[model samples]
Target: MRIALIYPPPWKIAAREETVSYGHDGPPPGHRPQDLDADFYQTPYGLFTLGAEALRAGHRVKVLNLSAYAWSRVEEVIAGLDADVFGMSCWTANRRGVALTARCIREHHPKAHIVVGGPHATPLATEMLEHHPEIDTVSLGESDATFLELLGRLELGKPTSGIAGTVYREGDAIRKGPERRAIHDLDTLASPHTYFDTHIVMTSRGCPWACTFCGAETTWGRGFRGHSVRYVLDALERVLARLPVKMLQIKDDTFTTNKKRVLELCHGIRERGLQFFWSCDTRVDLLTEPLLREMRLAGCQRLSLGVESGSQAILDAIDKKITPDEILESTEMAKRVGIKVRYYMMLGNRGETRHTFQETLDFLDRARPHEYIFSCLSIYPGTRDFHDAEAAGFVDREVFFTETFQELKTPFDASEEDTHRMNEWFFANSGLRIVHRDGVADYRAILERLGDYHAAHMDLGAALYHAGDLEGAEHHVRRALELGYPLPGLVHNHLACIAHARGDLDGMMNHFSHAAKVDPQHFVLIQNVNAARAWFKQGGPGRKLPLQLTVRHDFQLLERTVQPTLPGPLPEDWKAWNAIALPAEPSATYLRTPDVEGSQHVLKTRTRLKVVV
Candidate 1:
């Protein structure tokens, strides 16, 4: 049996513009935004675990990272793979891209069996099947065992009705199986690192906290499930055998959830002399000097603390369960222990306002985590915040996910204009200078003074581009470039957009090429370069010239040399693509048509494939 795991690309905004500052004040003097590459090393734990399971079952397994690869090249990569089954993992942000990828695979290989899993699928199983006919099954909940079982049944040419937690198509109807049991014994599961040859490991499953905006509780439940200390150390040993294992990214929602267990694990790592650096996520309140010192001694290089809000009101509203004092103390303690700390802040929570937003700024100034991540909250289905928003009259019940504006879905009950203003203020104030006055009401004045010159011009250029005023956009962009602004990557990207709009194919290519050159390691710029190349090769009407920007020596080599590889088997024709196996027992009603408009346009077509057995 052959299995292919596909991780779709992230949203353009998140992948390109969202930098993983971890807690840095801002991008270096002249910082540029770039695309986030989906390295095999960075592949999600679930996908790697499932891949390892498939391999353990004697199936040929491959990982197709379409996220790291440009969208245009997806078909080429799919055409190059050789596999029997295709599996895809997607989050809410990248659902559209996943759907598009599934459709493309079905169009190219109609006989290949397709499956969709991950956080997105768990809550939207019915919607996924109804919306995308090309997907043969949606593996709801934990899929490591269920997926392997489904593969076994398929290989034997047997009916898959016995396999629980799967939704598949049968004739004109879709059939869903009974809910599968979750993995209780963590030791039985193989290390995901075995499949990827990477150092990433999951020490625990499930989050202890119920953050209002998070969907983790709904997907994995609130109770924390962890592997034994022995199991974790064994996994680490296995990983160190294969790779240099510089950084062990513990993909636990809260590594410090079980204080005793974490301490035990830390002690084990120290005793074993693992001599490897690691990072983990934890709550601000969980940090203690003892734990921090023990972790640092055991090579815990970094910690990501979710200081979701600085305002006590917002924190309580979201059940963040930490106070400002706790946040400050935790930061100071981590810094004292010589441990790098990254603060993950949520900007748009319930009860967010100009005042509360300012409180966050003041908190950052006080706490001073190594990096600050300010993100607008998203109202995902199944979260308490989502229901609360509807209950509080923020979101209309009639509005579907697609119809809801991205900014409006935030837990923060504020106008879009206000949100934008706060976003601008957060970025501007996160720099070296204190550009904002504590009691000043002059928003525009503060923006003009504290904001990066190039960043402001870039914003204006972006507005013009969105307004379809390409020429005006180009003029502002050129001004940004000529100002000798430090953010060359952003400047180059805007120039690319201008070139794209003005029918300057060479100029578009040159700008993207320049952006990529300036920040060769930046995934966003790399993606832009790939997109530009693909568009140009397709004879599109845009700039097609290469960039002339300079970059760091190693980064330049990485850009020129690194190429993403395909994950699964390729099919010759579209007719052999596999359809999702519908459930034998109907538990819910299936709508003939999806609730949203244009959904049918995006729906995937199904094809029949012959079983290998």
Candidate 2:
């Protein structure tokens, strides 16, 4: 059987003047805020899982990420592709794209089986089928097993209507199958990491907590389930080897739900000599000093906590059973072990008010985490917030289909005045915030807890250099290399800075040259190297200029030169599809989507850097 999986764009996008070529060597240039505000570019991880399953069953699978492609290009690609089963991963932001792509596929391949499954499609399966005649089936919830079964039945020319965990059209009426039980033994499923090269990895499914703003429970059922420690370790080993950068985001709903499992996994990482910096998201209440210490030793770089709001009343209203104190204590603990603490703050929840809004800002000041990001409450289809809104007549199921917003980013039950104030604040104060930086003492404490760790040595060295202890900094930086720090370019970059401080012009350039050759892909390293090149181009040390250096263990890598590729047949019109030229200028309705309100920010970004497709 021939299977095609697609990740659609958020909306119909007109091509821009400048061309941004996709490459397989690395991701396109880092996302500029205005051009790529939402995370729509990332191909949904589920598609890889489904593709892996199909491949194991001896079926050919082709996966394409058309998330940022222009509408014309998308149409061209869709028209060129032929498959028996066409699967798409839908989300609230990309619902419009899913429909558009489905229609394209239906027109191109009249007999192809179009299946849509995702958070958005799962909750509104019946509506999706009723409104969009192009989609043949909607797989609800965790769909690995459901998808494979559907494929088998389709291959044998059997009816797909009776498959569990699916809703399909039958004689002009939509019929839903029986509820599918969640997979108890996750190890039974093939690991997507074995076949795909993606920085995103989810070792667990479902969050035990029923936060009203979250739709996780709806997506993965009520309780939490995780792959066994060994399974996760094996997956990690495989994924890390394939990734260009050893940094990964373990995008679980609640990564540390089972503290014991995480601890054992952390220990296994060190024992197996798996050296990589990684980040995970979890609740504050789930973290502990010991677990954090072990995690840092095993190369845990950052811990992101979902601290939605600071007001206890607001927290209770949203059913977030955690206190502000817990958030603070967890921040301190993670910071103590040299793990960067990032808080995911939210605005305009159930009981949000001007006072409560101020409380959140005050709490941020008090907590002083390493980083924080704020987002407005978006009422999705399967969340309690959505149900409550529907009941109160604030919104209906049709809004998701009709409205053009990337997400319904609005205040839940807040006064018009309060909503106005919150919107004003949010517009001014959105995006990531680096609130704090670890000092020498902080990194020293980390070294104490995690003895002889390469990352710790490098971190301490950077801190020392920043604190103007050049000699002490040099020693630790050299020790990091001796301990086999994975990113030696960072080490040499630091050495270059130290050389500059000591008036060794030749040594500084030598070190800089080495950093550029070895680690030219990292964004920070690229910036610094460019600065050095410009400096030398202008004049030598005789110019008497103070060279500014970016001295930090920024764990970010360069974006992929191209999108992820799978082992499958190329599109029939691959050459023509790649040759399609973008319009020199956008049309009047280019930014018609509500998510993209204005073109000013986008224009600003475009003039500065090439937009990554």
Candidate 3:
């Protein structure tokens, strides 16, 4: 039977009931989904997993990531693909959007069975099926085997409610079926990489640690089960042979949780002589110098560490089980071996206070990771923190069910307003962003949220320019300069590129000079810098002042004295170096010997110029 797997648009949440407002042009007020690169959405790995399994079982499967597509386009796309089953994977935030999508698919393909699964649906299996009439089934826990079996039974036109780890609607009542055992041998699962963009290789399933704020352990259980070394290598080989993916992210809760396995994987990769730049995340306490070194040799480009907080009390409170010293050592080891470190930090966790925040800042000052993303502590369903928060009357499951991701609120000493302000301050002071989708908000929010901050506006401007919005690009870039966006040099460099594009030599030279004064390190800026320096020696470009120079060719002037400079403002040190060309076949030639200044710039060419200015 034909199956359609969907990664819903940004707006949907799995628990989205019949009565919530989500189909508006924008996301719900005070709510934004944490997308990782909004411009290009990652393939929903869960959908890929289920789809791959379904495909392998001799069932036809079609998958779509509707995150990047506009909400209106969703219906148009879904209507075209006819399938027997419509399956969607959603996060808690996208619960409303998933329900909306389900409604759309239902309207078009009413005969198709709708199955919703993911972190959001897995927890509230009964609640989701009951609340959302559009939903036919909610897959709970591990769905790879469960879904495969469910689809087979459905193809045979049988009842689905009795399927393990699944909740389905029957006779106006929501009922859950038998619990399916977690797949102990993860290698039996098909490689989802062949189906979608990201080769999100989950080397292992389940996290042993019971971090209070995280809901991972709840969903996958506490036992850490990993695919064998050969299984992993074989999976990678399959993906590489079938597709052209240069990078593979080994998405394990803690990649190095099994040190011997990691070493073996690294060694296996090297033995096969297969190389690809990859990344993985792990706990700070799990890292060691030797293991990291092996990973580096195996072409690990980035290492993401969860240095959630600096306060020992807060760390212990959250059951992080990682010390500040361990964080530093791990960061140092990763950096020393040339693996760029990315930190995942959470603020406003248990025992969080202004003092703890400052402690985190201090720790960051010492650790100095390459990059980091921050998040306010999230209390998702099935987490210890969630249960405690609920018990304390801080949050209700009904509200959580209705609002989904937006319902999560961090219970910190600081007020919501204060936490938000602190988050911005943390970004400005500590120089770290959050783990959010690098989408339109990510670029526009800097100015809209922070009120004209400079650093990334240039980036936004460039992005706008590339998107054919020349006016918007120019405005943002100009605003960036006005707000003293830390990298003013880039502003001048950008202006130089525009000037160069418009064939304005003086404009290009003037901006290039300003950029060079500010130390042009970026490639384009460096090009303009070098060009400006070469075009004029003492007086910079844009200087309308013309030097009367004569290129005397055997006492005869061979060139014009008046050289036209392009229109725009000139630099302070603009100069015109005039010279006569003297080739090897020429009867007369003039050459300058080395001067006191150790600039050994030889003017060797097809012909050299003799200066008579």
Candidate 4:
């Protein structure tokens, strides 16, 4: 059978890609930038693994990366393919997008079998079949074998009764098959790389850590599992031989979960002289200077660390073992050794407060890793955090459905006003400026108290730019400069935008020159050159100012506080802003209308929003 694997695009946030879903409230307060790109939406690994299994079984296969392409484009890519099966992976965050995509596929190809898989569908298979009629079957956990069996049945026009790990709709009722056992001998499965032209490999499955907010423990269990070192090494050798793979992403929940095993893997890679750059996700506490140095020697170029919080209390609340001190030491060590670090921090956990929130800011001062990711704590179903929130009275039990979980209202440890204030505070002082603060005086006060007004200004400027408020963007940019915010290469580019908008040719040229001088290797400079050429061609001003500016701030403070330091690099384009054409009127409106007495209750009572933006 011919098959098309689909991945849905993330939600749009100020033109950036963000994960938005019906089951959880949007990202935690002040966590992610409005413009985070869609880099994370790569090909779905599960589908690739399943597809490889199918192809090995002699079926024709094609992949449609809907995450990279829109629904219309995905159709175009698969237009001529005579595929009998369509498989889709949907996470809670991308379920809406998946559902919409499924409907479109049904309309375009009514006779094709539609199958759904992934974490969101695993536990809620029945609900998915009942609610979404377009989806013919839902594959439970570990879909490779299950998908193959289902396809085999489809090929022979046989009943799906005996298939394991599948929930199929029989007339109006859903019939679930036997629970599929996870493949223990992972080596027997075909390498996921076979399905794609590129190289990718997984060293392990499951994570040892049980962070309250994470779904890993709930989805894959707390027991860490891995293929033998020899299996992993052989897979690497095969990939290196067949594909021009410049980098290897160790697609593990936590690569350092087994320190001894990771050390052995690194040594093996070194001994083989793989000469490939690699990246992996790890916790800060697990990393040591020696391990980082060893990994660096093995061509490890990037490490994404989940430094969930700077507040010790919040860390404890979420069962995150590392302290603020550990975060500081590990990040500093990583920086010292020359490995690029991406810090993933979580905001808006239960028990969060103004004072504890400040602890995070203080922690940021010392742990200062390269790129800071501020994400809201999402209470995914079956996680400890979800239960904790529900037990603590934060979750509205009535709307918590077994299938298609929903968050009725934004749960807060403080009032909505206080929650919003804390969010603004986090954005202003967390070494990353990516929040909107029009009338958030308390948050601004906290920034001022922390000596971060300059950083706050840069953040506000970026927020305005993203919001398409050009005048406001200019005002904040000037304020950032006046407050003596460090103007990195990206900052200079932002200034050039302002100068261009104001028609100050000399100022634009000067700022652009400064930007080039500071970060000659900046990617924005390429765009600058292109814009200059375009302006000259149009016989217009040699440079036009940008309608908005992007801001970058120092995050080096995190390094000083954490321990057993690891070395790492920061993200490129430290700061950036471009000239955007503003809409004739505000494209989106947010209301701060007065709350009616029973309105809050009613709003809190509703399980799911009729329309999710």
Candidate 5:
């Protein structure tokens, strides 16, 4: 069977000037600036897992990342696709897009089966089926085994109903089957890194705590389950080999939930000689000084903490289970070990007052994390906030089907006065705020903990260069290059700046040329190269003036080569396999089945189809 898994855009984005052909023989898509949201444009990692599962079973699969495509391009791609089943990832931010895309698929291929699943669809499966007839089935929660089984049933012309972890439409009634058990052993499933070259990797699933605004517990169940250290290291090695820039985001719910497991994983990474910079999200309370040091030595460049609120009252109300003191201590400890600390702050939760708001701001000033980003509370389905709001009649399920908002982003139970104040402050300081810069002393402390590591040496060298220690900076920067630092362009760019500091124009030009030749994909190197070209074009060599240089390494890489991360081309007789009967055995070890037959409550409402032009 031919399966197409799509990552839909949040909404219909307007066209932009940039265009690129996305592994299709047609006119390229107009890449819009709105599609550049790092959070939204990133193809969800689950689709890759599903594609791998299908391909392993000798099926043809196409994983298309239409997350950044304009509406016209999405239509063209959807129309061109020839598949028996269509799988789409739905999130609170892109719920409408999922519906729109499902409708488009039904219009083009009336017989194709449509399946939707994600954090949003897992909880609101029945409502989704009732509102949008375009969606045929909704796969609920950790759907690796469930998805493969459903595909087998579809191929054999079997009913989608009576399958574990699925709710399907049969005529006019929506029937849900038995609840699918959580996969006891994650390693039993195929690893996504084996097939796709994505920078995102999840080493674990589920969080122990149920933060009010989060739906992690809803999707990943009540406890944390991590992949074995060996499994993770293997995934890392495979992904690292394919990436041009050896940087990854370990996107787990709570990465450091198992401190011992993390320590062992870190040791394994070092033992295997896997060199890459990574960042992970975790709670501040789960961290310790020793663990932070070990993680930094193992190439943990940044640690993002879910410090929802700095006010103890607000934290307690949200069941955050951590005090403001813990947040401060964790931030200081991570900074002490040279790991850049980024706090994920929130604007509004259960209880919000003027005093509490002020407390958050004051706490931020005291904590002084390297970076912080704040977002308003969004009441997602299956979350504590969502259920509580529904029971209190504060929000109706119909709002999700009616409201055009990207997310239900509103202050939960905040007073009107407090809401106004928070919104004003949020709009003013919403994006990532870089509050702290590492000085020479800070870098020295970092280097002491992570000795001779390429990244640490480069960071300390940059700090030394800024502090006017040209000789010391040159020695460390050269040392970093000798240690086989991945991005030599950054090292040579630093050398160019150092030479420019002195009166060595020839050395500066030579270093810049070497940087451009080695790795011109980094934005910083590109900026310096463009500046040099313009300067020489204007006869800078003959002028008696100093050329200004910008020396910075933000670890951002421009993707020069775009390899299509999809399954190989199918054989001519591949479709004939679908007609062959095959047993659908459970892939992973099952824990237990829950009662999810659910009340047959169907909402008699029409879904409003609106696309933002």
Candidate 6:
């Protein structure tokens, strides 16, 4: 049987530009004040893995990432792959795009078994097939085995009624099955990297901790199932031989859940002499100083902690099963071991309020993470939070998934105005702290800038300053200036932020002066703008805090240019794309990394950098 797996583009910007405009009142459900969640898109490793499974089952499979392609062009791309089955991955953010692509594919091949899988499809399986007649069936969870089984039955012209872990309509009635039994021996399966030179490695099948906001259980089933240390080592060796990637992100739910396995994996890396800087995400309570030190010695350059909120009450409310103290101490441990820490922060959960926001800010000041990744609380199907919200009448599944994101159900405990204020103030002050003390952030931005990335670096710089890494933040902000940023006043404003944070009144005023000289629209130059921005940083509502101003990339051609650049798919010779040094453009988002001056911070990053869902 022939199969084709396609991952659709993430955005509908061309079709919904007018409807997607930013709101001045409050940030949307998907956006943080720092950047739109759409800024990054990664390879659909799930579909690729399924393709690998199909290959092992003696079925032909083709994998394609049409993420950057316009939705209208999906039909054009699908024609290239004439297969008996078409599998598409779905996510809430890209559900509409998936539907559009599915309809086009259906138009071209009416008889093909068009199946949808992934976060969005796994929970809303029956509803998805019901709401959109184009989709033939929705695969429930752990589809590697199910998809392979599906193809064999189809080849034999058999009914799919026997298949477990799938939902489909049968004579006006919907049939649903429990998720497929979890794959115990993960090593038995072929790594997706073999089919596509991917950078993500999932050494585990499920998560042990059930966070209220996460949908891991809905898709992967309950409990943790990690691959043997030898299995992970074998997979790592395979990737090392295939791609020239320097860093491999271990895409696991709480990679440190099994400390014994992690230790063995680190030992395996040393024994094998596989050289690469790797990172993984895990809960704060799972890490120990000794474990972190061992990890660093084994070439783990970074550790990402899901420090979702700073407020202890909020943490308890979300069932994060972690304390604020654990978060701080974990950062200290990772820092002691020379592993840069990246904190994944979320605001506007069940218990969030002005008081909780203040607690979050206070925690940020104390923990001093090397970076802060900000996000707003978002609802997904099948998560505990989603069910609670539905039962409470906060959202209606009838239109929630099919229609435009409803901002009225936004989960923040504070009023819309207060939420807006929190976002703006946190972004501004966070930059001053991160830059002044913590250190530089991950070089992901530096690698991205070598392509079509075009965010204002001052935004990042400001974030860094607030996290307490002033020099690193300044390095980037100045790089932004060197790249001829369209708004220099923002740069001046940020420099002033750094100065003001460190008690340099003269230096603070100096930057503010430069900001005013260049553009009178500087936050510090505008009446009350500086006051509002500094209010959180200085802890006051009406008191004059301090001098404040606010704000807040290039590309190159290669020999045989790669079109629709990074964060998108490669045409061919993708391995070569990963192995070469990238040229820089003056207008691209510039970032300073530990790499030598004038060198691109290359990771041979996956077309989409890998992160756990």
User: Which candidate gets the maximum TM-score versus the true structure?
Assistant: 2
What's the lDDT for all of these models?
0.62, 0.79, 0.64, 0.59, 0.78, 0.64
Q: Order the numbered candidates by TM-score, best leading.
A: 2, 5, 6, 3, 1, 4
Q: Write the per-residue lDDT of candidate 5 for residues 267-309, one digit (tens) a residue.
A: 9988998877788999999999999988987878889899988
**Over the full model, what C-alpha lDDT does candidate 1 score relative to the true structure?**
0.62
Q: Write down the RMSD of all candidates, one decimal each.
A: 16.3, 7.7, 21.8, 13.8, 9.1, 13.9
Clashing pairs in 5: none
Q: Which digits, one per residue and each the tens of the lDDT, describe model 6 over residues 444-472?
A: 34324332211234445666776788987
- Which has the higher lDDT value, candidate number 2 or candidate number 6? 2
- In model 3, how large is the Cα lDDT of residue 337? 57
> What would the TM-scores of all predictions be?
0.66, 0.89, 0.68, 0.65, 0.88, 0.70
Residue 448 error, candidate 3, Å: 47
lDDT for predicted candidate 5 compared with the true structure: 0.78
* lDDT score of residue 201 within candidate 3: 72
Query: Which ten residues in a row are the worst by lDDT in model 5?
Result: 597-606
* Candidate scoring better on TM-score of 3 and 6: 6
Candidate 1 lDDT for residue 126: 71
Q: Tens digits of per-residue lDDT for model 2 on 521-561?
A: 45556567778778878885578876777876765433443
Give lDDT tens digits, candidate 4, residues 1-613. Answer: 6676666543212213523342332232333332222223445567767777887898766554445333344444445445588888877656655666677678778899999988767766777777679999988767788888888888999977657888998887789888777777887888755445333467787887788777775456557888777778877877666433244567688888888888898899868766555778888879888898777666565677888778878888888888878877887676555566777766667667667767776776666565665655555656676676667654633333322322223433544554666556544534333221233343244235334344455555655655656687677677766754433555566667666666676887788787677554334443575576566577664344333332332221111110001101111321111111101121121111111001111111112223231
lDDT value, residue 250 of candidate 2: 88
